[model samples]
Target: MSSTFSLKYMSRRVSCAFNLLQVCLVVAVLALLVTASPLFAENALNGAENTAEAETEAGVAAAEVIQAPALAAIAPAPAADEPLSPRMRAALGYVAQRYRVSADALRPIFHAVQSTSQELSLDPLLIVAVIGVESRFNPFSQSVMGAQGLMQVIPRFHKDKLPANAGKAPLLDPVTNVRVGSLALEEAIRRNGGLMEGLQQFAGATRDEDQTYATKVLSEKQRLEDAANRRLGRG
Candidate 1:
């Protein structure tokens, strides 16, 4: 009886030891799985965050590209018939007032001056100065010294130098006078080497004449420009 009891007790002890070993193995595997699961979850979260940031950057880039062409297309280009400079407009107004004529009346004269000046390589300001000094822009003016029209061109000079149309017309016609005056100014510039020098040399005999003449004509130009500015409500 004693021998049988010993064998049974030994077998029960061995069974308990085997069950403890099995429990220890299962605990170790559970710990390893817990640690690795956290690493996997962190990697997935990081990937999702990187994807969201990339998408945001792409959206901003797309918005900028879409807006660029729209802004450029909506912008207005400058017009071909932009208004004249303030000084030029003022000069026109002064001529109109002094001549007792409408601003429209002087447009043709202004155009003629511009055209002729370009053709002759002369300054339109110099021609304007000569007209102001010679006849105060009065196309009907005649001098006792035989100087006639806006630039006070001598009839003899016109007959000798000008074309037949110039000789046949009355010296007081504004277009004819301006045409003749422009030609004379071109000749003067050629003879004296420049517009300012020609004016100085030609007006040498009169009182403080060259500077005075330039100042007066420039002043007239300014006045005309100022008047035009007022008319246009441009200040």
Candidate 2:
């Protein structure tokens, strides 16, 4: 039997066995990072009004994506007509506030995730969570393991999967990075036969029996869910 280990939405599932306490710890660290930079809150507030319009345009700005495969899908993407759902909007806001980036600037990233969701059956929140765990939203981040861009994908391992026209340093491009990373994530889950193992493979930590990397990714995802629910009055 093939192990179908997709990282489905945690809010609705009884699987994965994610540790909420660990999630809370990550959130606390995130909070401390924001607190250390008070201007982040101020910047988020100042950019609030612009978010609506920018987000509208941002949805239109998200480039196209190619699919490697869908990992049994994740969070439901809102209706095609309403790409930016309340949950998605809430997620964008939280990321902007936490990362000290303007909401207007994050619109494109959300849009990209949304677009990818439509194709690859992954949730924007999950992708957002992975990005946080991988690189804290830093498009230029490069791990000591040779992972690069916001998704921390190792280019050498996935150059063939990249867009043909993507020039040198393609992984550094946020849009391209997200697209390839999502595909890579799907492939990993599909190959590993389950979410836990897939995430372990993605993190290059298959031997970690405690599943720390998967736990961290899920924790970040839970945080996104909480933020979305709170913003949507569904908490």
Best-fitting candidate, scored by TM-score: 2
75-100 per-residue lDDT for model 1 (tens digits): 43332243544544566676777678
Question: What clash pairs does model 1 have?
Answer: 89-225, 90-224, 90-225, 90-226, 91-221, 91-224, 91-225, 93-224, 94-224
True-structure lDDT of candidate 1: 0.69
The 0-to-1 C-alpha lDDT of every candidate, in the order given, reads 0.69, 0.82
Q: Candidates' TM-scores? A: 0.50, 0.64
**Residue 78 shift from truth in candidate 2, angstroms:** 20
Model 2 residue runs over 4 Å out of place are 1-82
- Model 2 Cα lDDT, one tens digit per residue, 1-235: 2334433454336433456667888999999997877787777876885897798777665531222134225323333344686788999888888888777656667777888867888877889999988988888999888899989999989987899798979998777888899999888998999988988998889999999999999999999999888888899
Considering summed lDDT, which 10 consecutive residues are worst modelled in model 2?
Answer: 63-72
Number of clashes recorded per candidate: 9, 2
Candidate 2 achieves a global lDDT of 0.82
